[model samples]
Target: MTATAEAHATRRRTYGAARLLLTLTALAALFATATPAAHAAEPVAQAAYLAARLRADPVYVTDQLPREIPHSTAPAFARLAKRTGVPTYVLVLPGPSGTGKGLLGAVHDRLGRDGLYVLIDASGVSDATAYGVHAPAADAATVALYELPYDAGPLRSFERFVDVVAQGSEKAAQRAASARERYGDEDPAALYLGPSDRDNQSFLTGVLLTAVPALILLLVPYVRRWRRRLPGAKPGRPGAKPGKPGSAKLDSGRKPESGKPESGKPGPGIRHRLGRGLVPAAALAGAAAIALTASLVFDQTRSSAAPPPTAADLTARVHRVTEGLKRDSVYVDPESARVLSAAQLSRLHDRIRAFARSDGGGPVYVLLVPQLTEDESAGQYDVFTATVHRKLGKDGLYVVADPLGGYIEVLNYGLRLDSVGLDLGLPESIGSGDDQAHEADDHALGDRLDALMTYLDKVPRSDEPNTAADYPATPEPVDSHVLRPLFSGDFRPGLLMGALTALFALALTAGVLGIVGKVLRRRNPAPLPTSTLPFTAPTDPSPSYLRRTAHTELSALAEDFRGSAGSGDSGDSGESGDSGESGESGESTHEQPPSGPSGLLPQVRAWDCFDAAMLLVDGDIDALDSPGPGPETLVAVVVLSRAGRAALRGEVNDLCCGVNPLHGPAVSRHHVRVSAEGRRRRLLPVCESCRNTAIVEPATVHTLLMTLPAPAGADGRVPYIETDGPLTAVPNGIPRLIDKVRETAGVQ
Candidate 1:
């Protein structure tokens, strides 16, 4: 065969390999998309199903409420509802802009509670109107009073109205067989769904919109496969020049001989077919991209087309939410609503203090809003407020209208304001002007935001909650919490984790394709005759090439131990030549990695691990020391760093790890050695030994480690210092411990 034919054969082989890869990549992407579906909406659906189930239960009841509320408010509502036989309505508005709309919605919901299902009809009512209190009509089957903030006097009047209604109903019941009969007939119970509930449907809609496109992208490549075919052309005519059209050519990064269709004689081998398969794979990948793009565009268009929540719907929702407010304990602004006496204020302060202790932080806010009767404008208070500062400035309450929302925003920004802000100083410009003061106040509130920030800093979280957020610098797999001990960052170190995943996939694909490629090559080997093309060019003989590889490897091994690095390098004169070779590259082939003395992992520094390990070794050790473990065991907890944790994890699985494996090469092969005291002793390093006896206080070690970020070695080589001698000889001997064990076990 001519040189052109030989080159054509190589081109065919190259195409086959490319085809296989393209096909595999497309398949893998589809698989990745399908697998995450099980997790999609899993948390939301679970939360929704739980809510629905709770709603269906007889004991499950909800109250309508204002957007902002005190922590101690929920119980008061329940108690008031039980004490008074009138349904309560809570009027909650979105903000200053929607006060009228909010109030009307609250009253509408209140009127509908007498019916069996609490039906609400916002049919004719305009969304933008302040609420009114209406006396029930004379002919109405059951008397119901509509109560809300209608005017300057209505708030105090509403309270009086409630008292009168309660009294009148009791008097009327007195005429009945007994007071129990009256009480039973006028049961005061109502339900409300807050703005959160009203907006949940919208949230669900948004989720569906986001997810549907991803699902469609997953389906594309497979659906379009059959319609796509490889482009084909016939081989050149039999007598035509070798470089004719319909020909294939190959260049091996060297000069190409000529172009020609390699398939002039017979069918290509399996390798050639596999190589050609790349074209189809590439086509499939393109289809996947198009499908994903189209789906995203469609989703965006649909999202844009959807209308906002209707006013009537919102009014009805607000009403249903506010009905429970009547039964709730009323909150009068600290600055206004003078009806709340000194005793009430004192009681409120006590509640605030108790809440602060329970929450493990300072009171975040002491919100004071005037009732409608006091002054309509005083009802609104935001982060930016003069009265907010007046009421809470000295008390250190973080006054914000939407405490939770503001907190969420600060947390999302990765600003841990709460844990670090206690010592922070206030800016001088904060109290300059009313508006400036308010802006400063807003910033201060955000700066001091704690509750949400606390959750992010210490709480173990599932990524699903904030999956859409930017990923951290580290990559960790999402797995079950039960396996959290085993799945640590140290187990799979560094930024390299992201690329490890891709490489794993590539390796798996290559392994699968290699087998397929071999089968195809067997039937149709390379097209050109073997004698026509020389198999070898003068480069290096295979044996000599392997010998050189062995020499390079030996040089690397010798340089593994070097002076001023490790103790093993002192006498190894043979390493100098290899060290020189490594130095020429300006990058060390073997650099010393930081480890504990003798490469032992320091467990004592980790209180949790040390305490746990001690407990595992001997239960009687605590009793031998002061304060037995029965009570003291609670105080001891084991803590471990990432590296130490990795060692502990391996130990749990009965694998060689930490000092046990590392000591052999780092220290002497033998465990027994002489110490500085001139006594024969087992050289159990500080990393492997407990700082105190087997019965050490968990807190003692933990506090010590937390204070010292890194361990102190004799000469900076060790991660931990030897604080105490190893327990080579047990105190009072093995026999004493055996006797104690027998006594505890109740052996005669």
Candidate 2:
């Protein structure tokens, strides 16, 4: 193949390879993103297995509850619990359902009769139950078990119940008695239901966040199109038409009509300027306004509809609960600690301390919170492990459990995670809500702790454990709070507002810059050229013949004009010769030529005019010699022919009317021959009356010359004709006329 083809093939192969690589990269990125998401969706069995390992504790709270309870209500409930001598366990479900009994039973089995189980659905439904073992007998009991009235709703009624119980007086007992009397025994099968206002608001906000920006983007293009179609719209580029602004023909640098009003004004009026400038400004302003408004709306919505806490919040809460943990002991809730006897607490503390001593590091900190979502539980485990890893050495284990949610997450910064036979079963084992049915006499919490310590004891230590001095001192805080939800929870609105504000500021800056640039461009317009030469000619000549021909033609034309000026009525000499040579030409009915200086003066001047015209034509032809002639240049040549004819005819008005020198008697031509020749040339009549009158007017000759056309050669030069040859065959007839004038002047 040719070099060009080979190069094209190489480029095509390169492009194909690049495209393939780009496609593969995009697909790989997509797979990389998708794989983690797929992995994060844990299987039901895996969740159950993990749930089974959780250590049940007193006052089990689910992950669904808010991180902090209301101060007004929590203190009252705690007071009520203290007065009743029963621990209060709160179970906050994601939603109300008829199946709440199963969850309640599980909590009841986990904590036993020592605690009061309170089930509060997210929708504000409440159910408070006191087990028979924990409740006082009818004779001794002053306050009967009561449910919040269905009409009052869970949140309000639950708060009221806490207030009534916290009062601890005869009036409070009477109120509880009155509620029991009025509502009677609460239905065991009744389902808790309430409104999820936050969830609904969040859904609506998300929809608007996506749609508003999209609508604004779509409207911008449509608005621009509408503005363009409006009458008297300003063009995008200078010297362009109103509607067809991007037309290619405008680039030719031809002068376009100024957009000034008809009052002979030099520039556009005030109204026109305003109309042109305001439309774009308005479009930009509108987009910015819409974006700003949407951003504000989104911010408000996000703030109002903050999401529930995730794992990070749970982790932070765990840290708060265990802020001042003692060495050689697991950090347990004070209320849960109350449930354990002094001997049991001592034994538990000893076991933990022994484990810490065995590793010569720190005790394995066990945190058993009430309830946390599965995700939050996991996050808590990570946060606790990281905190322990930083505070203690890496050779430590942090186990966090959510007994209310029936799940446990283990974080082993040490070698325990990689311990042999350390599989803790799937999360489903604990989360299946069947643990209560299989409850054994042994305390589930104690058994789980024992199992954990046993596993830790068997875990092989790292062969190259660093000494105490070698360990990092004053380690950096893990900063688990940074992992908190960015566009959710309490900080969502602030984050959204900040981001939108930045975007708006950037857009405003760009818009202002664009407007300023346009104003500056308008203030200082680019200058346009005055002359219209299609192309510039080079000084050097390729072949000597081209330069010689142009010089000779110009020189000969100058000589012809001088000769024609000196001679008087030289046309008769040429006419007499032609007539004598062809006897039939003398018999024609044609006027005799004027024979004097006055008559010849017109022809002399015409020759002089023709000489100057030829010089310009020769120069133009020379400029186009190398590249061949452009279409515009060729058209300009025809226009020059008409101009030359007009100049000649203006000098001699009666030359054609007085005589018809070239006609023969045998022809008796009925039409004036106006030759239009050369490449791509045609012929047309100059004057029909010339034949009838047997007289040729100067106008006829001028007309014939002006309308004549010529073809440029491949090299852009016209063929050089001899001075005395037929003038009509050449473009503009100036070259041939010059030659004829030279011959006539020589004879004189």
Candidate 3:
């Protein structure tokens, strides 16, 4: 009981004189504290007094100094506390207070009360504590700050907390509850445009970033058109006269001195051409991007609020089950999301013991839990079960079932274990003892496990060795038919952050490309579409340019080997496309003696190829002084430079990719349908990456072969590789190809 309660008790039990004396003493103490001398009291004494003050009024204010929440506001709060029906106490302290838990606990201890106590500092609800009751309102105090607008004061949060703490505050509680839900999840991005996946957001951002520079370029001409129409826009220009006000207007109506529109302002014909040439691809990309965004947005809004658990969480959960499996044959996750009835659990336990006693090849261990997210396992339910078996190192038929989906995954690990080649309508995993798993809401998961055990008891394992045809072929993965995770929930923070960073990079790249494209267009005329050949790309690198690059590299390598003063290296080569061979070759690994041209020069290895490459790299352009270099000879230098640079590098293995030399060395040779000598099938060396792609892709991989000039055949580009090509010399070493290029180019 409080001091006030004790005083009331005394008034009822004690004599009139004693009661009167008690009241007078209390009054004297109250008046004494009200005096100016009370200001000198220390903070500890003030805290003591603050606790005492709570007995009289549920709200206690520390000082009489100026406060945003003045001392007068305490009485109104006191009334609010009185209306709560439960005992509520509020303590208001001065500033510089760290955490409120201590003060709240100290005051509650001093008061010796079991009630809702809230400590309010100058900052706001410093802390809230429930002495002897469950109070969610304690968490609400901090949540209110986030719920309120950033500019909202602490008083507003304090009010919301009190409003939710008391009974019969339905109106306040409803508002508070909604705000609490939205507290941490408020979308902070300016481009939020409501709820949507990060991919969609990135797509829109990329499109905008890409289009911005082009849009700016397009606007420049219109801006110039407007400026030219303006009177005296540019002083002393030929069109706009200084003296005449109508000079600009007169010039606008006049025919052009050269018949073309002004530099910035293109005519209708030019605009149409630009729209046809430039706008279609951009518009198509924008439409595709927008469609992708809309699809994700539609999917996200309909999904759940919880994020799918990560692989680590699932693995941890499996480890938790490993302990349970050791103790019992039937291990069910008690805290599983898919709740099991007592009867269902009892039945499942009996079934497990029965299966263990059966004549099956291995004893059965069963586990039941909720369904996992499809993101990890599309349809393969054996991952967790396999993990459990690996951890336990047991030999038997182990079963893990999703109590939510009634899906059973059976894993056989022991050497004595028999394979169950059963298949229901489902078609991804090896076995399907999970009868009604494909059909939603068919049977309880525990009941499903019981049914599977009963089926296994009827079909016991055999001791005889099984042949290859004993089990059917493994079914193809039907991931599309499986239930994938809902996109509506918040993904893991790491994934979200990674996706955002990637999208930002993509947007940056798109912006750079846009700027580069605009600059290129401004510098050169947009080439008209071609009729006989492919679309016009005026900046495409010619074979001559590649020849110069090859010479530059070969010359540098020659100088580097000859010079011991410095370790000068050539610039990195890249894979780019155009004219003869579409893409440039990847850089060769050429160190001085071990890997570079110097490495091959020691034993006089590939000397003929190297000599021929050197001859073409210099002799064709310098000695003959003919029209630069032949496409065949130029491409030959490219081929020889790679082999000559590094004799033992992986890139030089198997004579590189026969189809595309730029693909680097063929990791393995693939049998091809292409015809060779005497109508026999041919084998072509291909890079591992390209080889893997060839298996799934129906179409053929692009060849790096360049056709010869029209003189060989009318508009028939006879590929340099096809004409006096190295096809015959491919399987054999590069020496024959070197001699062949020398014979063809006639470079001696």
lDDT of each: 0.27, 0.38, 0.47
lDDT string, candidate 2, 306-393, tens digits: 1334445444444455463544335544322122233444666777778777753354666654433222333344544455456444
Q: Which 10 consecutive positions of candidate 3 have the poorest summed lDDT?
A: 247-256
TM-scores for all candidates: the values are 0.19, 0.32, 0.30
Question: For model 1, what is the error of residue 736's alpha carbon versus the real structure, in angstroms, after optimal superposition?
Answer: 99
* Model 3 residue 602 CA deviation in Å: 76
lDDT of 3 by residue, 292-321 (tens): 664565343212211233335234455667
- Model 1, 369-430: lDDT tens digits are 32221111222222122332333223333332232112212111122234233212222222
Candidate 1 positional error at 536, Å = 13
- Better candidate number, 1 or 2, judged by lDDT: 2
Model 2 TM-score is 0.32
Name the lDDT of candidate 2.
0.38
On TM-score, the stronger of 1 and 2 is 2
Model 1 error, position 231 (Å): 22
Q: Model 3, 747: alpha-carbon shift in Å?
A: 82
